[model samples]
Target chain A: MAKVYDAIVVGSGMTGGWAAKELTEHGLDTLVLEAGRPITPAVDYVEHVPVWEKRFRGLRDRNAQLANQPIQRECYACDEWSSKFFVDDHENPYTTEPDAPFLWLRGRQVGGRSIMWGRQVYRWSDLDFEANLRDGIAVDWPIRYADLAPWYDHVEEFVGISGEPLGLPQLPDGKFLPPMELNCVERVVREALAKRFGRERVLTIGRVAILTQNHLGRAACHYCGNCERGCVTLSYFNSINSTLPAAQRTGKLTLRPYSVARSLMYDKKRTRVTGVRVVDAQTKHDIEFHGRIIFLCASTLESARLLLLSATPELPNGLANSSGQVGRNLMDHVMGGGARGRIDGNLDKTDTGRRPNGIYVPRFRNLRDGPKSPFLRGYGYQGGGDREHWGRGVDQAGFGADFKRAMRDPGPWHFSLYGFGECLPNHDNYAELDKTKTDAYGIPVLKINCRFGENERAILKDASIAAAEMLAAAGAHDINPFVENNPPGKTIHEMGTARMGRDPKTSVLNGWNQAWDIPNLFITDGACMASSACQNPSITYMALTARAADHAVELLKRREL
Target chain B: MDRRDALRLFSATAALPAVPDLLVLGRRLHERLTARPALRTLDPHQNATVTAVADRILPATDTPGATAARVNEFIDLLLTEWTPQEARARFLAGLADLDARARAAFGKAFVDGGEADQVRLLIVLEDEALRLKEQPGPHPEPFFRTIKYLTMYGYYTSEIGAKQELHFEIIPGRYVPCTPLSAASGPPGGD
Candidate 1:
């Protein structure tokens, strides 16, 4: 007889890491199965080396990207330094209509996209939670602000979000460490924006996951500026650096990497998840493991894809997709609408060190007790200040000794504001199985049919205008607003495929992130998101997973599973 | 050897005609070097010419420019290796038409033109390229957009370009968002 575990987490990514850590710490025998290759942190990270040290000087070969990740080029970060972390697009092909293009950026490593995340951590307020209910779009989320507040605090305390307390309702205040200080230009911009636009528009240092001071055995960030290469200092809160190690310490966790979980095994008599079926990526052989409970944290679309592929007599659409909402309401933040300009005043000033993060302009419109916009939801801005570097004159053919001397010093101070606008959940924008296409493993690929609606386009247009206006108010010169040609998922913040809601008729998961149909199975990744809040969803995913794991342990003690 | 003989020898040594009777020689060289079943889907002639135009726009002078940085080669690699087959074909077809127009006007191939003549030709074609980018109907050229990207990538990545032109410090360990204008002057130092 095979040994039965108390729980099995389907992924070892952001939420899966949290689930494993919390479950094992609670003395539950947890088995974390990762679909991708194992990531050994110390060995994998090569960020500390100088640029001259690498073979391609941190540049990827043309053949490598073409043969491996054709779809990943949509991301600027998927270069030679970080391409290894991204999924091979050719092997995992997906379909989109000719008119619509969906850029599904993913990392199938143990840490998942957490290793290559932007590290910005912000909390959503009642404004985001109540948006759907107010607009009459999707069903209202079962849990509200109060229910998630404590979990946010719990997550922030452990993750060490570096930010200032801005007592704004739209952007709720999180438990934070000392915020990173703004540079001179940023200070000027912040003061000017506040004075010119009133309290509605405020600029603050971004709430990043990187630690300001040493906490939980991890050292503070050294400001190396090579974050995409992976933080060797463990300053940034990646799953491998924090949660995975914590899970290992409990000794109740069994981490099996390269174990691709294909689907969940349902026990008809028990009316619960009996086990999980996995295929060894290397051997291509199937293996079954029995678990009392299961956690589907295999990202948003992958989790949905797994269920859609696992067809049964009871679940023709997919497992636990009773309401046909398993792979619906796909949303992502609409980005690339912003402005860039040269600052005239700061021509002589220069700063040292490339800060790992940027300055944030919190959600100004539709905040608590603020003026509403024509659009249903609101957006935030992530901008930064920097002196123009040597590369600005390359188009003009400025070179030689004169060019060298001129470039030795910094040029004019420049600023840019990029919008991170909310994408309203539309049931029409969804992911489903494409029977026509199959992966190397012979599994049907996900067919993503999504496009930005009127709301998202309006948000982008307003954001572009607002960004230019902000720069103009800050006394910027030659401001230019850039509107992206692509649609919603271009920002790579894909969410809401298997959303959590108050009603089983409209959602696949409940308030506790447990499946409505299968109580033993929980989903706390981006899939459980009821709405795509403008803020980065990783921290919230972690908090939700931790809360769900605690609930799972309690339910197991009572023999619920 | 005379200039024409020298051009021919040079072209032969470089694996092609330096100054051939036919303008298509340059086009054929590009096609032969970049030939691959996967790559054949996209036209190499269009990719090369567009890259050449980008090189002309930001030509190599005292510092490295687009061609010297192998921006065109980079683009070819990008198209052949990464770009979808459909996009590649569209890019190539657009490039061929661009060269054909240049040949019709100058009575010589685009590559064989004097620097001033080439600059003038590009200036005229730029409007057409821009139109294609903005209101792309059937078989959009995307020449202007590709040129813009190539210029951005080529210039930013060059050593003198990034260091002198952009004034980029490989590692500015600290961020001072607001600082005195005078603080940015003088030699590079710790943040």
Candidate 2:
């Protein structure tokens, strides 16, 4: 009775956009349900706007931050420049344990977090895929680098990534655009890491989703350096900026903004997802849209919440969650640690514009084919050297004309190295539906209980030591390095709730990202991650979504339903 | 956030923000009519004292300093709108301490005192504020440190100080990481 589309993708974020593009290009009519407002980039994207032009003079509204966005305020992107990209924490409340602080920084908009992503794109290799199985902790990932390599090529070809080739087996090279040049300090750090520390710890220009050259009708990055705010030139890869527009060009896509997908309608007798139950964001009324297949790409925790909230009498625990792993094994990258120091003699040097990219030190611990280290997995450093601005003016000794003269010369170029370590998936670190909490739309919210494990703390300590060593090797002075294993989910790389694995008994989704029990339902977002790889996960999500969409279309054509 | 350059805002914002005072707006409007831009957060005496302190912190020479850049107005605006009540209270108390010490020494208000008197009082406050050894005051940093920091922050970030003095472009379209300071323009432009 309802308008039945070929497929329905819940969410319009990173994976959702990819799914839409892939499905529509494959000639399967697809519907994209977004819970947030349609992004109007010209009006919304405020890149390059100077701080002095802002109403708050680049200062975030403290009242709004303190009252409504306490959690969101914790994010660097939640500043005066692009706070709109983040959700007000009050409107989208989630509970966390008193001791374990889990930061769920989300943007409920058409572009979703792709509009506010770090844009760092890294390829996960066999090292990550084999970690869980080798350690005998979680179920084995059904597929490995070989299976996802082509998909990575497919996504990278479309999304022009700007990076250098490392040729490392654990970190494979992708179809890349011209890489941006490293600064003087970054070059020094890279050399020091290579010559002094050896090839185990490799430093290269960060592999980023931002384009160094034009591709796919999108202009190259002008290097204005503000990628977090929406890019008008389509320089970086964001759904609203890239894939969604491509999907629209196909005309096989039906984009329904402000359609908050509540859950998938599971047909028990048919053993397939019949449709998706959505709530109109404005009207606050439930509506149903039938689809032959459904893709749940509504981020990690949200996708898990959708299933946990849809627990039916037939599937008492949760649909497609026969393994009882629907809302379990939550993991995020262990962050909030590293070291920084002053780099003198670069006084004449200045970064004219913000380089949207930074230097990256690839994972060096517990490496591939090498002797096992103290930790199971490893961590990588992502930071660069830059000159400090007048914000340092306050603390500098002296004032008046002399103080003014002192500020004329910029502060010494400071080199910092921060570690983004892999967070091991612990069964106890999980999120489930909070019975007490409901969002503005009256849908249940998540109650997260995620924290960094012992491995994370140890890795952070090692990362700090390594970062300090690299800085020193680079001839850094007044080096003050620190190691703090911050709360989980702080990096915003939350994953592994509906992890894909070989066994149906141990995992919710199969290698194809299809639920083992519900053949017609697929999840290819962070929820589909089998393990929390050290690299940024967005690129992987894009690859997996494109691959899964193609697989879904093949299954449909075969009349498998 | 710079690839995680210790996003730890070691400054005052790292601590729990103090409650905002409600009377801030009314006082803000009153100060506007009294001063050129009027002060919202600081009273007449406090405003005069802060203006004197800011001017001394960055007095005018060949280049425009704190007063020319309206650093006092900037401080007032932040105190009224942005500064948390606890920090604002400590700041105002710090200004009062400067005035009280000035009176105790010179038998006149800080603003009423000679340039030398203001400089001497500021010197003593500077010594008192040096306990933190800089690094943005570990936040709620004692009063003199906070005021001095805010004064410089307001000055250099203002259009006059940034565009006129240091001379960096707000938006340089492309990134040239190692350009000479005098080759193309002044110190690479920032907010």
Candidate 3:
């Protein structure tokens, strides 16, 4: 007989790690299930390995990649060093509209995408929480900024976010460690923005999850610019490095890798989730693990797919999907292209260390309190300035020893701002379990249909033009601006399939990320996002998970679940 | 519409190989088993030509040159395993054409020619290659461009090029924003 736990978290990623940490710490026996292979940072991480030592010399094996990973190869982090961390497209596949290409990148590992995250973290204010209500487009988020503020503080204290405190209500300041210092050009741009537009456009160092100082026995970042390859020093906040370790320390957490969660088993008599049906990835044998409460933290699309696959005669749409809103209102951050140009000044000034972060141009358009714009939402820019190095030699004209010598010295300083825009929730942009498609584990895969609508195009155009304008104000040169219409899912910030809403008829989950129909079920990953706030979503997911886990534990204590 | 027509015309001419697909199944199997990649594409004559051309492109200074870093081996490995089938055929044909050029200019193959004569032939080839610029296909890509491009890439990324010639500090402990160029004495790309 399978041992039952107090709580079972399906997925061992960003939110799952937080759920496990919180549940286990609160004296609950928690079992964390991970679909992918277990990762040992010491053995798996190759951040220190130089390019020349690799068989393909960092170019990667193209023929081999073409065979296994056609879609995953597009990612920048999926290099020869860290391609193993990314999911193979062959084993797990999702369908998209041929005309509307949605690049669904998945990393089905113990740490999931947390091990390969961009590490940019930010806070969302009432501007995001109340976006739908004010616009009257979708249902209002059941919770507000006031409800999540303390929870944000609770998660930030443990997660160690190093950021600058900006006292704007729209983008509320968080509990932060000492912020990273900006480069010379970034500093100049900040001064120029202040001089030209006052406090309207603020440029600050990118508030990242990477630790700047020793926090909770974790070492500081060594300025190696190799955080994507799985940090050895535990400087960056990955699930494997931070939360999972914290959960392990509690002695109540049990991590089961290579366990692919098929669906949540619903008990009609209990009127809640009783157990989770999973297939051992190695053995292909089905197993059921019972739990009082269930936390579905399996990314965004996967979690929705699980719910849809759990369809029974009582709930034909899906499990706990009485509202028929389980797979509706799918959203992702509108991303792809931004603006960049050459900065003429700061030529004499070069950086002594390689900063793992970049400059952040916070959202300035479509302000709730301020003047209105054509677009419905705004976008923030994440970019940096750098002098061209040996890599530029590929583009530079000429060859021979002189060309080689020329390539050795630094070239002109170029500044680029890649924007991440807010993607509003549209009911049409949704995911459903495909009829014919099944994964390697015989579980139905997600058929995702999403696209950037009119609002997103306007945001992209404004962002590109605004980026060039800001650079021009800072006395930048050779400014080239164009709206990069990259296909959706390129940002890897997929969210809002099982969104929380005030009304049960319109949404699946409630304010606390608990299913309205099923009290014991919770989903605190990107699937819980009501709106795709312009800021990065990982930190918010962590805060929401911690808040929900604490509430679930309280409910368990009272025997309400 | 013109670009479409161009694309249409190009597609009409199949992305077919100039020669039979050169499958070194035995060599590739052996390389995979050993786990250290072996040169599978270029034979000895072609290999010698690549090395000779690569040396002239980025000759040895105080630091090691392309030949010392074994760019031919890297190029061969890439051409064999990484490059598309069509491009591989083009590259092979280009190699034969290069040797033909050597025979045309002098009386023997490029490897058999004197160093001075080889340098002269390479200079002419470089001019011819550089003239094509970014225009690839329909017309055959010049041999010099292929060799020169791959050699530079292999050399600059190699340990001899990056660590020795271009300074790369593995663990720069602090974030000092503005240092003078004199103090910041390394190429920016560190792997």
* Candidate that would win on lDDT: 3
Error of 3 at A448 (Å): 1.3
i-RMS for every candidate (Å) is 6.2, 2.3, 2.2
Tell me the TM-score of each prediction against the true structure: 0.80, 0.93, 0.92
Tens-digit lDDT string for candidate 1 (A1-561): 999998899888788889988899999899999978887768788665554333343456656776678888667778767888888998778999988989888888888888888899998878888878888888898888898889899988988889999888788889898899887788888899988988778999999998888998998877767676787779898889888899999999899987887778887676688888888888999999999999988999899998888778876888888879999999999887899998877555556556688889988767657678898788899988876654454433332345444644666777899998888888899999999988877778999999988888898888899999999999999999988867656677889988999888889999999989889989999988888878877888888888888888888889877
Q: By summed lDDT, which 10 consecutive residues of candidate 1 chain A come out lowest?
A: A392-401
lDDT of prediction 1: 0.78
lDDT (Cα, 0-100) at B3 in candidate 3: 58
Ranking by DockQ: 3, 2, 1
- Taking all chains together, the TM-score of candidate 1 against the true structure is 0.80
Candidate 1 lDDT, B53-171, residue by residue in tens = 76776666566666555556556655655556776776666567566767887876676666677777766666555555456467554555555555555555555455544455654
Give the poorly placed runs of model 3, Cα more than 4 Å off: A395-397, B1-38, B103-131, B134-143
B-chain TM-score for every candidate: 0.60, 0.72, 0.72
DockQ of 1: 0.17
- Local distance difference test scores for all models: 0.78, 0.84, 0.85
TM-score of 2: 0.93
Question: How much is the lDDT of residue A536 in candidate 1?
Answer: 78
